[model samples]
Target: MLRLTVHRHFSTSSAFFANRAIVYHSNGNPRSVLSALTFPSLRSPPPNSLNIKYLLAPVNPADINVIEGVYPSKPSPTKLNSDNVFVAGNEGLAEVTGVGSGVSGFENGQWVVTGKQQCGTWRSGANVNVEDVIKVPKGASEVGAATITVNPATAYNMLSEFVDLKEGDWVIQNGANSAVGQAVIQIAASRGLKTINFIRNRENVDALKKQLEELGATHVTTYEELSQKSFRDKVKEWTGGKPLRLALNCVSGPETMSMARLLGSDAHLVSYGAMSKQPLSLPTSLFIFKNLKSVGYWQSRWYTERTKEEREKLMEVLVGLMREGKLKEPEHEIVTLGAGESDEEASNKVRDVMKNIMEGQYGKKVLLRLEGE
Candidate 1:
């Protein structure tokens, strides 16, 4: 049975219900600042709200950057036991368990993901405003819905927003093995667009290349290949001298500049992240003579700028792709918090995972399942 309560007070119930949130009082190192607390559980949804139980949440790099106070957007502090604190997740898949009196169109057992940005989804359960979440179709898989809003959306938008790519047209991008990068490969393949994917050379690079190619990548190479002038001729040969119209960059540095160099006149270079933590420098001749247009894309801003209906439409398209198997779930691992665990044990477990993620030990996406009892 689940123990039930609200805020700091406990409410009598025949069943036992509880809520545990991974929160940080101050922004700093994730391992040092992140801790677990047992917040009150919802007995019923507040007016115009829906009580939601989180099913799965992912520990994205942006979540860690938010805790480090480096990301552009910040999560609004959540009210818990009369005090406000920041929860540590940005994306999650949840199930509605209770609906407030004034709320309609939602009921128990509906699956959803937050429509709002930086929703602080790292909790077992909470009462969320109706407008904050978008419904996930029943056909969508748990992983697809849980991880949809950020990476896949970013990939879909970046591909269409910057350049008007057509079938057989070539696109170039760095970080070809990143989550968004992989999605780019698949989505482009679905649309008949070709991608020249680039990544850092690694010990298992051959296997990694094979994996990406299996997902529909036209070509997979490393930055080492991009550094060679000879490789530019090879890329030219692959595209039959057709200008690469779009360049997607997440890792910024000399490699990004090299990737941009492959673009032809009037091409657009869209950047979404700076994993290299270095400045993006390019030659003036490229921008002046080549007419290269440089731009940045943030998926959060895209949501804030659009209407609820528009957001749903995008989700509808993506979910349809998911149902059709055009877009596959990201390669990931789940980090679970058992219901029987103590707050200390849960906090330690999360911290250990964050530590590994920070150190680049874990290559695939990491999801979280925090069970509160």
Candidate 2:
């Protein structure tokens, strides 16, 4: 059996349950600072709350950055009775196991995703307000529902909100093999927009290229190919001399500049991530002559600033596309946390996964399955 180390004290209640969470007391390297803490689950939720049992939570790159204290947004330290630590996840899917007296529109066995940001989803169970969770359709795939909020939403917004792109127009983006990039390709294709994708040259480059092509990418090239002057002529040929109107940059630095070079006059380049950890450097001529507009996108901030109804409307559209089989979930690997595993074992597994993520070798998103569906 898993060795449960109770990290917090709890008051007596009608019924008690055990819960485990991955938390950190201070922000630093995840391997050093992260720990698994077991505590007493709430016996009964408040009148307006529901008892949520996490089903699957994704380990995103941003989650690691948050743990490292490098990300722009931060989760506040939460006091779990006696332990003051921050839980370490931002997105996940959960099941409503118990609903309070005043809670409506939710019942036991319904799947939901947190509606709020910095929700600390990396836990087995918690008491949350009804309004804090968004009900996902019953038929949604675990991977799709668990990951819908961040990468897919980012792609959807970037493709639709920024450029005023239309059918047959070309959109260019680097890190095309990434989850967001894949989503971009699929979403754009669904909207009749073509995509020019750029990825790093790797040992399995051909296979990766083929996979993306199957997902409706118009063109897939390498960063090295993007740097060459001849590539611009090739893009011109591909578009039949049409200007590429929108460019999405995730790998900043020189790659971003190259993406900008592919844009036509009055084009927009919206950057969402900097995976290369390098700053974006652009030539002034492109801006002065081409009138290219540069912008940054943060899906979390969008959720924070937008009205709840507006957010739900956008989610409804995305979910509808998903249900129609137009948008497919990115490939993912499920990391199941065993009930019999110790806290140390769980921590080790998470650390190893995070290391693989840093190395960029996993090739699939990692989802933490706290329990069987």
Candidate 3:
């Protein structure tokens, strides 16, 4: 549990007054472009707004691309002190410290997260529109609430939107050790759906396999294992010839195509990422003969297209899973930046972690704790 105080309003002399953020002036490599900014004390929110203080924010791989100006959705430049900059962070868990007039659903101390994309959530506190945020159950762990808006939502949505999956159904995917992949495995298992999970061969392959299997993966193997002439035969034996109706691809390339080939007729191949930085290739025969359907998924677009009530319902279901222990928090490490630190000091610390994240130095998910605790 997090130990922190939520103030309804800020006074200049109070420790809660200062707000710090990770901001970038231009698009470039993260270490070069990312910086920290501290602003004056926050005031009460205006009508239909809420004063939110973030508790935990995850450092996702997409965050790096957004900083480099390569992602499709980018945050608008925000004013921090005298400088206009893009404060970084797409997802976080926040506490409502102050509610504005005409805001009837929220009050001080309730936890919430934004339903809209590119919320600029890295800052310690801000005034956000009430309609843009959704309440998270207080029973949710801080990390689960912070990270839920993206990966788990993507996993759940992909499984549900693409296919009419039923119990004993089979699903196949590559990049099976990824955060989203792990969520897919767990969610599928809860529904009695089996998963054929594939990952790159790593040094600790055996240990990795055990970890995923413990999470309920039906079959876990390396991409190289797919090369075996009898691999399809083995998959058939596992599923008893049930059609693999869905394939989730994050690492696109020949590896993904190989996974897709195992899907039966009229199956859907839903791709959400391309970690390999390689183009996907599939013989026209797969489409003409097998009736394979390929489509791309973006969680940001899903949020934009859905109604606020729909989004709230999705959160309600996910929070229920968290409380029931059907969902688990991803492996993570939190990088904390003290509010009392100088801007240069805080910026340097954030940049160092960004550098490490870009280099794949952190094997687990990286989360940020910018203000208290």
Candidate 4:
């Protein structure tokens, strides 16, 4: 039998229990298991942890990549598992249904979500340290809060960390229609900056333009259009010689080089992912004369390593934006994978959601359909 030590709250005579999870028994693949195998509960909830009853969790591509054993992050062992296997998910919104003695800033009925790393969040309940979670505003949408991690935070930090773009300065990004891209667009717009967004061609190009425009995009163009000399000329005419200060590159390889080329001198190019599975290429001139900078980002690393006070400040900024309706979670197609849900059905849901996100089928975030909401 599997032997594990958890806080003293959970004990089971049987060797197994159930919690919904996504598992990749081997590399390069993954599937969700509903009512999946479980083990002993917490012997006692950690002294400072608040037992979270999950409200919602996002199904991010990075989460999928982790399941495929492609992402660099590795989950830690927790009492939630029966055989001590892994459960996969990035960040999610929860409620403080139970709190450990001495934990402050949390109480029953308060809404909250993860603000740090190392605590697994896919299942129904979680024992998270008070410092690792942030109290979400009562009026915030659980769906939107579920997306507070990774994309939203990444967009906020990258734009804030890189060169300070003024109202007239522009930011360019690819996977522009991606969730992070959308977040960047909104945040920049709310901050009075302009945006030059690029996206791959999809089935409904016309519809997509209206959507981005509504989100305050200054301009939206396809990859092919961006490669044209005339397009760059047209861009110069529209921007009135003000160069793009930052290029957020998620799908690297040649696109990374192209984004760098589009920036003004002393511009910063931040690379967060390599969706194209291609090497990042750059021209020598950018490094030598233009003084261009390329930075890599992984939100998991950022959240875990940053100080607790820093986390609170970041969360407060984002929540304030949401309160003003300046920030938002993507519109979503929700897929439930919880109690009484079948594994086969849940597997199909995950596959469909992944396809839609990667292929740009849905113009919104794909959330794991949850029970509480």
Most TM-score-accurate candidate? 3
What does candidate 4 score on TM?
0.85
lDDT of 4 at 311: 78
TM-score of each: 0.93, 0.90, 0.94, 0.85
Overall lDDT per candidate, in order of appearance: 0.87, 0.83, 0.86, 0.72
Task: Flag clash pairs in model 1.
Answer: 2-16, 2-17, 3-16, 3-17
RMSD of each: 4.6, 4.4, 5.7, 4.7
Better of 2 and 4 by TM-score: 2
Query: What is the lDDT, from 0 to 100, of the residue 31 in candidate 1?
Result: 89
- In order, how many clashes per candidate? 4, 0, 0, 10
How do these models rank on lDDT, best leading? 1, 3, 2, 4
Model 4 local distance difference test score = 0.72
Off by over 4 Å in 3: 1-17
Model 4 agreement with the true structure over 103-158: per-residue lDDT tens digits: 87777888887876635566666667788787776545778788887788899998
CA error at residue 182 for candidate 3, angstroms: 0.3
Worst 10 residues of 4 by lDDT: 1-10
Candidate 4 pairs with clashing backbones? 6-43, 7-42, 7-43, 7-44, 8-43, 8-44, 9-43, 9-44, 10-42, 335-369
lDDT (10s digit) by residue, model 2, range 1-373? 1112344232223123267788877777887777766667567887999999998999998899888888877887776758777888999999998899987788899988887888799888888888778787655687888999999899999998887888999999998988899999999999999999999999989999999999989999999998888988999999999998899988899888878988889998899988898998899998899998889999998888887677777778778788889889878899886666666677777778777888887878899876421
For residue 41, model 1's alpha carbon misses the true position, in angstroms, by 2.4
